[model samples]
Target: MINKIVQNMAEAMAGVKDGMTVLLGGFGLVGQPNNLVDALIETGVKDLTVVANNAGGGTTGLTALMEHGRVRKLVCSFPRSNNTIFEELYRAGKIELEIVPQGTMAERIRAAGAGVGAFFTPTGVGTKMAEGKEVREFNGRKMVMEYALPGDIALVEAWEADRWGNLTFKLSGRNFNPVMATAAKTTIVQTQHIVELGALDPQHIMCPGLYVDRVIHIPYGDPPF
Candidate 1:
């Protein structure tokens, strides 16, 4: 097996550049890849398009990117109550925003990874969310078709991973990481623990090694939250 480990978050994020679309894996504040987020902030890459369920509560998750004024667009399902930076940017027209329903967001990413161009869902039928979108009838119900969202890079958090890159997430953090892995051109993983090859059970691996391009193990003493 090829070893996918990297020395640090900076090395893992080496290829990220300006004006790139990045998919961030996490639900709320639960399983965000903090180390990678810090490194990206430090890299100072600009004009980023971030896709996530929500921006971190404050200056925590993707909010860090917003603080740097690096984010040009956000394709997210919802904005957290404390995400003042995002709200301000949106209000000021400093950033472009595309709001999607929570369930539709997940399906969009999954469809992208599966190489599907578009799929229909009934989640937003008859609502403002359905405006300008392609609509189709399925089993007597109206459904809107949404296109897949593929990103240039995907930043994800994993609870544990092997040297070969088999990854697993803890609890709620597993929300979007797995799907985002396959939808991005490059997938960078920040993990709480790293183990030798064969350390993790095959059945427990939520994301296989082939989908992962790099892995960084956060230091044991480092604060995750």
Candidate 2:
């Protein structure tokens, strides 16, 4: 029997190591795997390069990770929030930042999962984001080439999961979880509910079991950091 469920947070995060590029799923705080993020912080791994939609806010999840100085760089669309963790680290020269356009960032992650070598888009054409990148013309419009974004590990949160690792998200929580699941070497999920193998409805499963490597049940509520 193939079971992807793990009994504890440590087992779920066993493969994470220092200096790895980690993809974090969430739009702000909605879809983040707070449990896994907290575990990663506890592991004390350093020099991580994180890819996410926005730099985290408040003193939990991604923001807490940044505050601990575990991350070396961040590849994200937006870095500013009500919290000053990212800004403090950035101004103090403790971290590196790569600003990618929101649409391009999503496409890059999707491209990695689809096995695409590269893609061209007009989102950042003629801007500093396009600097040093190969540009081509299609129908007289300039497009900048962006490569796929892959991660060593991806931490995601799902509303529900089964023993097989199939996942379902609630409303806006589905944001980047599905794509991040596919674009990482090891995708570890923190699900609120872990059901029996056949419990998940096939039509509603957003992320298939094939893409998930580990799942740990975390239930509902904010996990301590």
Candidate 3:
């Protein structure tokens, strides 16, 4: 098997290009892949469609990405947050947005990873969110058809990763990271700890090596080969 570890964040992010859709794994600021985000900023690719749970919480990370004019559109549940960066860019029409219900958003990413083509839900029924979308009734209740949200690349944060790419997440830090690891063509993870292949307990593992493509060490550590 080919080694999945890269020497630096730059190498980890070398595949990201302009006009690509990326799944950024996190909920609010928690679990956001800071090292990868920094690498993307340095890479300076633009016209991106970023999918995430929320816009970056503060004036850095995702906010800094917007300030640098990298993202063209955003698919997320909460666009408004601690920083006004997205707001200002959005108001000036500098960015595009699609607001989804939080639960629906999670399922959409999960559905993509699970190979589910489409599904119906009641989240956006009767609201503007359902505009121009197919709707139907099931068991006397209304549901809107939503498509899966697969991405060209997914950047996830994991608390620990085995040398072979199996990952385990920390408490709440697991937010969105597991599913995002499977929904993208390539998944690059920024992990806090890199353990030997058998170091992780099978029961504690949250994502298998089959889904993860690259393992990167945090604080910009050298590649773990």
Clashes per candidate, residues 3 or more apart or on different chains: 0, 0, 0
lDDT of 2 by residue, 52-82 (tens): 9888866788999999999999999999877
lDDT of each: 0.86, 0.91, 0.87
Top candidate on lDDT is 2
The CA-based lDDT of model 2 is what? Answer: 0.91
| Residue range 41-123, candidate 3, lDDT tens digits | 89989999999888777666788888899999999998888878899999999999999998888899999999999999999
List where candidate 1 sits over 4 angstroms from the true fold.
220-225
Rank candidates by lDDT, best first: 2, 3, 1
Using lDDT as the yardstick, the better of models 1 and 2 is 2
Q: Which ten residues in a row have the lowest lDDT in candidate 3?
A: 216-225
Model 3 clash pairs? none
In model 2, the runs with Cα more than 4 Å from the true position are 222-225
Against the true structure, what is each candidate's TM-score? Answer: 0.94, 0.96, 0.94
